[model samples]
Target: MTPRSIDEITARADEFADMFEGYDPKPGDLDAPVPPVMAVKLAAWRRDVAERELADAVRAAREQRLSWREVGNAIGTSGEAARQRYGATA
Candidate 1:
């Protein structure tokens, strides 16, 4: 897959922010109901974006000669764990 440009990522982030900004619940409406499927789909979309960004970052780090240990430390995982998770994609 082609890597996303910084501009593209920024635009997407802004779009996500806008989504939340538009969804502010009314004051004192503690029991406001949201569609269950909407929540599920939003969560899935966020996960998809996160995984794509992570794969891109891992590939870039490998290209820059960064060790898996360094990547692991940055991502709060063990070196072997990072390798096992991202090696094939990187």
Candidate 2:
């Protein structure tokens, strides 16, 4: 998937968050069909949450003076690639 801008991610993520936040369940909802659009939005929100979590983990590792190579190894990527993707100037 192409990378989304932070603004877009934040906006869309919040929309999904609100959707589930005030959700009121109805009887037979489990057996009812869900709108495909909502399903897609849920999937996107999940991805956004996981990515933010990964970013936080990476930031912690960097703060501890961990090498990009080590981070890459742990995350199944190359050292330089990891650094570039995470916006690590060093």
Candidate 3:
């Protein structure tokens, strides 16, 4: 099968969220394996969400004039390393 497009993945996640909307999963439900197709869709959805969140955080940090040194300290990394990883964008 072909890989799903991002829009398709997001739609699938939205559908899945609706399935469990306003309900918490029990322990067994949490550990249950979703259908393989759903699993793939969920993984894609999760990755997209994480990437968006990371980008948003970077933008916010930059907007706040947060330095790599401060970010690194908060994340338990060295100032230099954080600068190397995130300074260019900031």
What is candidate 1's lDDT per residue for 42-86, written digit by digit as tens? 899999999999989998999999999999998999989999999
User: Per-residue lDDT tens digits of candidate 3, residues 1-90?
Assistant: 999999999999999898889687777987887999999999999999985676577667868988767777866788788777766666
- Taking all chains together, each candidate's TM-score versus the true structure is 0.62, 0.60, 0.45
| CA lDDT, candidate 1, residue 8 | 98
Please estimate how well model 2 matches the true structure, expressed as its whole-model Cα lDDT. Answer: 0.89
Q: Pick out the ten consecutive residues of candidate 3 with the lowest summed lDDT.
A: 51-60
Distance from true location, Cα of 85 in model 1, Å = 0.6
Residue 29 lDDT in candidate 1:
80
Candidate ranking under lDDT, highest first, comes to: 1, 2, 3
Top of the candidates by lDDT = 1
Off by over 4 Å in 1: 1-33
A best-first ranking of the candidates according to their TM-score comes to 1, 2, 3
Where model 3 places Cα greater than 4 Å from the true spot, the runs are: 1-33, 73-90
Better of 1 and 2 by TM-score: 1
Top-TM-score structure, candidate number: 1
* For model 1, the run of ten residues with the poorest summed lDDT: 25-34
Under the 3 Å rule for N, CA and C atoms, how many clashes does model 3 have? 0
